[model samples]
Target chain A: MLGDNDGILSGAHFLDGDHACAEGAIAAGCNFVAGYPITPSTEVVERLAWRFPGTGGTFIQMEDEIASSIAIQGAVWAGAKAMTVSSGPGISLMLEHIGLAAMTEVPCVFVNVQRGGPSTGLPTLPAQADMMQARWGSHGDYEVIALVPNSPQECFDLIIHAFNLSEQYRVPVLFMMDEVIGHMTEKVVVPPRDQIKITPRRYTKLPPGEYEPYRAGDDLVPDFAKAGDGHRFHITGLTHNEKGYPVMNAECQEQLVCRLVDKIRTNVEQISFFHEDGLEDADVVVITYGISSRVTMRAIREARKKGVKVGHLRLVVVWPFPEEYIRRLAKQIEAFVVPEINLGQVVLEVERCAAGTCDVISIQHAGGAVHKPRTIYDAIVEAVR
Target chain B: MSMTPAVENPVEQLLRSERMPHIWCPGCGIGTTVNCFARAVEECVSDLDNLIIVSGIGCTGRVAGYLELDSFHTTHGRAIPFATGLKLANPKLKVVVYSGDGDLIAIGGNHFIHAARRNADITVICVNNFNYAMTGGQIGPTTPLDAVGTTSPYGVCERPFNLPFLAESCGAVYVARWTAYHVRQMTRAMCEALNKRGFSFVEVITPCPTLYERRNRLGSGLDRMQWFKENSVIKNGVDTRECDIALRQKIVCGKFVDVDRPSLLEMVEAKMASVLHRRRWERMSREQQKPIAMRPMKG
Candidate 1:
């Protein structure tokens, strides 16, 4: 039976992305999950419910997304690797707690299975419209790590990475999975527990009375202490001091919100990850992420056959924006083409990072489905023009 | 704190006195209730670190902020779910949800019944001041019928919820009620709730001196307390259905429900443990065999 130690399947399985994501979290030592079932995301919790008992984990079907979001944070503070999963409408309701998670610096994970939305736009349908929301959905000046997975295997791999990054930064890492990746079934090979490396929660070594919950060292990230661990501290949604007590003053607000944003921003090099193909000598580059990257791959290959010197840059970590790489690449590339399931979301980031150094072309899709190869091929053709 | 300190500081030890004197209004029952809560914790638990207080948004939600223990002042209408996570994640910790009627029952009512129905192992201290006290005396879920509120200036038209009935029907293992004036009883109830093993609820009718009391012309907080002393009846183990409070009417307060039912965690682990063990054994057997499988798929 799985204990506090090992629960990894350590074998290849033909699993849907949602199931693979669940195994990834379990393998990453996630033992507490509170979630509400929303389409394209329910399978993750369903599997956890089936697996948590002997696996030394807990799965709760909360009242709603708001409760689910805060519940995971509660679990996180109680010293469990915790997570919650939902699609667009549910994600909307969770926004407030997500902000609270940011404010309190609670290390947790949120899986957003991207669906078309203004409000419940399409439950089972695919969309990348939530890309911007993943960064700014919560009201406040805060940043979170967001990862996009294209296949079931990447879903397995990246969810673990998301947990690691979350623990390392003490931020709620957003696992931004689109409907296609979430519902897609493919082979995912989860390695042995010993082979997998995880970022354990950095518990404070300071004695109980000496410990301060929000006090950080030079890394700008503080170690955590669980509620019952004899470290008496307070956590609140309001702006707080280093001792974790709410202080409603401008100085405290500046001190707190700055660290929340800078913790991720300064460590962008450590957190930012992407896959680059044929970029060293290319004139035009095609950038994509999530399922959109897989769709754009066909267009890139087709464009290559026609002698277009267009390269591919697929983002595994979508925010902290990967600004440095985009800026540096923008200096050399003649143009950049971005195609996503949304009308246009990440393209705005690409254009912003490109900073008019080169032309940035956007291929828009309405998001009920993936883009046609011909359309992306045509966008690539136009970007290099 | 005042320029002149009070003769006796009952909550000095448990309250974050540096962050205080709290925002509770003059002659408010909230401060008195908080004092009782602190005293209850002091009596119940030898070790204070394991006690966690979580509160939602509102005047009563501010209770978590004043407590010196490990506390979480969470989002409005979310204290119970958050405490549910806290308790399940670490069973050793004693989790408590403290919030107001508006925050817990009006917007957050669904979670209240569900948590009680699931019999989540946590104590809930719901402070009912009759109206939405924080938002300036708006009609609330527990607002007595025909009472005056800012939003219901002509007197409230709707029937109020009998919180004890709601809690009892939803499967709480222990349920009780007391007015803020009943300090000793309220403190004892909290102590009992802290010791209870399953979902326990204690409803305290406190005076919202600035809002509920003033709008209803209930005179001062002192007057409200005096009225409670006159009108309240202690009916321990009474039928919850008849305990509802009405305007200028008899206020029935008591321990309404105390029974046995497995908590959500207990029920889940009990049902799933054996099946989970079989699967774990199967995984172990698989590990005893060939190499871990590997495959590559379309990307």
Candidate 2:
């Protein structure tokens, strides 16, 4: 328990998105952070380094992103709230351990501040190209939670949401921010300590000898025991049985991997967060998220002036993709205008959900900058025609 | 052979015996290293509850799976950083990283050096079996020069890493080396390293009888053990630079370095003490301050 303002800023302050993310981690009771300094995201840990010691938190600058990622998982298993922040290049190096966390059901946070990339793309700019990678980067069949914040305000609020989801579901929560949002400064009102809610670690009640480390209970999540609590259980990256022993057989893989996936798939509605505006009697809808959504706002208003009847669907929780809502809305709307700072990453989802029922217009930008309202406005006008 | 009395396992409490029979083969030196490690943990660490073992991927990495203490078999070459996290998160826990040569030296070498450079409060026990035995006898970072392996069938022309030298160079506070045949000495070294304050390293020259020995024509595990017994020079306090293993050469083994140094946790705590004290003072003074914490556990 944070017993004081040690973890909360608790007032309105003009700060950048990266600083807000740091505050969010502390407010969520995250006490351990291991990260390599990275552009657009380095400020997150810099802020943490200055603030953590006072809050009894530990910040380790690891040798590389690979080490940083696994280090956080280690802290998570030891009963500490932990996270890592990085950009595209670091995120690429961290893909393997992200799968390990998902496979092992370790609760932690990964904040990737999106920058341009095929390789070391743009250090100081923005891109949403990693949307697909966030869903399927690690080589495996599993699901993870990812949250996208549209502004500095949301970065503070939703990172707390990210940590809570991670704690409850026992999965890695990806806090997907972009350079545009990360460096953007705005007024963020942090709630008072008691007013904020946090999801505490669910430690198991079974006596040491009787407890099975990986056995799923009613909520489809197994209760955890911290490393030093005398429940000297074995945890591995290998596909394991309920006892957490490596079981190389297919049956164990089927059961374990399925649960890793279904736990998120089955809870899609609870995990899904999106915003809708002007949906009533609209013939066309514009779908976007992160900084792109902010840029699309002006486009939506302009299209309304042209009487395009265009609605806006802003995705707050990007992963688990809001399929059910989009699928239902696809039938009623004539077209879905998608604008993103990448080459049509999330728009593919819109196209899939629409499934030949409606026209999907993708307005793509190749990184280094956010989308312009005119580009999105043009797509809206074309989709309506 | 009958001189030693047969007895029940003394360190049985420290083993997850149900997970046995283990995946180890007869005469494989990994079992010997594991046994010595268990004995050291049994004899040295005062708090069994606080002791944890972290292993990386390899044949030797399997050691964590059988340990009764909280253990993690992490991804290849990652045990050091993972253990560093565990130690930093809860300073009360005694973190020990047990991994193999290829995992700890080749791929995870960066982490190994950095942890040592920072004097992280952890012990690293490296089992050097000459080659990557689990992956069918491939040449490893510690493979002896001119020794044959699956990948180096023509006899390895590449230079082998002097592990003790590397550890010493990386600023490890305690460094030692021993063959699996020297069980008593190995166990004693493990205990000493366990008791050390900062980064300590123990290199066990174990035989991979199944793969390494068969490929290199080193006869049986018995012959390898007999050869090491005859060839090893226990030169205590010898310089680590001369400890490198060449093909069928006299292997120098001993505790090379032992000194006191501040650990990563200590340094970090010292650096942050003032800031933390200030926050505590602010907390005590503030009338409206409340702890930002998660909800309490439900009964």
Candidate 3:
């Protein structure tokens, strides 16, 4: 099925979307993957389990989501680019560790192939309800990078990008996918090892005595050292100084908290990635992400053919909000329509980024159903009128 | 800030400067528990560089931060899973986990049973101090039924967990328990668990000085240690059924289960070997080593 297009197949055959993500991780130099079998996302771990051994990587089906999440963190700390994939209920169990990774600034990838949930609402269905939770789930204030993909090909590309951004920023980059994209079957051309960019976390070659684990120079990201690299340094969830020792004082807490939040917020422009179309003469812009964006794109094109001035903005990087693109569009567009499968997750973000320039509205549907193109097309037509 | 005292043995040095001054309070049993871990590592693991220590959030969770080997101070109730990952990633590395009562039994209960069922090659050192120490002595899963704590002002109503019994029932290869007062025995137990090749669990009945002491009116560290010494009985070939009854009434301390089982690493290697053998028929010799060709991208 995988006929060559623009690159060497890298011995990667055309598989389902889940297998593409697994192969993408391997191409990104991931040496370890841990997961528990939750539907929709289970195939991700299964494929990794079958392929990793041949690739000289390790795969483990952990007992639950909590263990699977932590195991990946441990492997990453041991100097491997590691990952874990899970669904809604499992992702709920992993939130605490996700916050820990944010606090400790561990470079790891969390692939959340989302299913409908207030609590396991639809185990095998698709919903983007976790868009807000992925950004601000854990307690306390911190910045995390999350990327959404609209297709099986983007799933492969974005997974590699997620690992790269995680290593480059020293933050846990989340790969957000709904069940639709995660389970979809499509042909993806995976480039060879040389062409695919691999970014490992920065390692300190200095002696063990001189290495400071959490030394935030100017980047606010800590210097990481792997276990067998012979560097000995402490890492804790408690507020600590640059050397990674625990500091119980409030001043240390404030300094650490401020820097952690500011690092990603300040560098959001470089961190945010998305695409915009037909903005110059568009009356209404449809803002969407993940698999929902695919439907919205179709709706926008359909409305445009009917003499409506419709445009589309698909977010590849969901967190960091794509504020600059939205701000630039705010001056030209009359109405911003956000169509999501959740109640009101990303619309709030669009509204805030709009900054009172236009009428920001949401076309929302919940409980495991797709956002049909007609509903979104009607919203675009009304907004254009 | 002063320099730590020196000791001759590396294990002793590990206990002194490497593991202490611990974050535990003056009379807390966590320090002694960590001391035993240091001794165990020195005795069992020949290469300290190959040792990986993983811990969860709590007073007892701080054990990883003090260890001489590479350690991970993870989130609450997730230490076992983290250690599971560390071991599977590199089967050459020896992984051990240290977690508190609340961390392992309550929040991490799912991981605990699952790790046991999978039979991963990891040693778990669970310090049961009877209450949540770092969280200001809340009633924990290991807290005695009538025990007083910050949350259990009128005494804890729920039944406490029998940790060793749970480990044994869930198929841990080695299951043992020792109080902090029995330092030598605890260290020996830890060393034995570390040496065993499958999922091992060692529960140490540690003392909580700050909140646990104030609420229970245990008076001091000496009084609690004395109580543990008098009440708990050390036995061999202990059954999980009998242990649960003892847990209801008294403290049960013993080497409950020690049997061999196939570890997760062993199973993975076997599977890989089979798959590799199937592909061996089409293998090429070392003489042929040509670089493959690639296609160009449009972008």
lDDT for each of the candidates?
0.87, 0.89, 0.80
Candidate 3 Cα errors over 4 Å, as ranges: A1-15, B1-12, B15-21, B153-159, B209-219, B227-232, B238-241, B244-254, B278-299
| Best-to-worst lDDT order | 2, 1, 3
Which stretches of model 1 miss by more than 4 angstroms? A1-5, B1-11, B273-299
Q: What tens digits encode model 2's per-residue C-alpha lDDT throughout A1-385?
A: 2336566778889999999999988999999999999998999999998887667788999999999999998888777899999999999999999999999899999999999998988999999999999999999899999999999999999999999999899999999999989999999999888878899988999887788889997678998888878788899999999999999999999999999998999999999999999988888899888999999999889988888899998999989888888899999989998888888999998999999999999899999988878988998888878
lDDT tens readout by residue for model 1, A71-139: 898888878899999999999999998888888888899999988877879888999999899899889
lDDT of 3 by residue, A1-385 (tens): 2222221247545666777888788778787888889878888888777766556667877777777788888888767789989988889988988988888888999999889888878989999999888999888888899999888788888899999999988898889988888888887887776678877688876788788887777877766887655565667887878777778899999998898888898888889898888877888888888888888877888887898988788889989787877887888889999999999999998898788999888999984878889999999888866
Which of the two, 2 or 3, has more TM-score?
Answer: 2
Query: Could you give candidate 2's per-residue lDDT for residues B1-299 as a string of tens digits?
Result: 46777788988988899999999878899989988988887677667877889999989999999999999999999999999998877777888999999999999999999999999989999999988877888998889988999998899888989988999998899999999899998998998888887899999998888998888888799999999999999999998989989988889999999988888866765665554566664553352222111121122
lDDT of 1: 0.87
Chain A TM-score of each model, in the order shown? 0.98, 0.98, 0.95
- Quality class of the docking in candidate 2, CAPRI style: medium
Candidate 1, residues B1-299, lDDT tens digits: the string is 55975587766789888787788888788888888988887777766777889999989999998888898899889899999998888776778999999999988898899999899989999999998777777998899988999899999889999999999998999999999889988888888887777899999998887888888888898999999999999999899998989988889987778788888766765666456557664564343222112121112
Which one wins on TM-score?
2
How much does candidate 3 score in TM-score?
Answer: 0.89
Task: For candidate 1, give the docking quality class from DockQ.
Answer: medium
The C-alpha TM-scores of every prediction are 0.94, 0.95, 0.89
True contacts kept of each: 0.83, 0.77, 0.57
TM-score between model 1 and native:
0.94
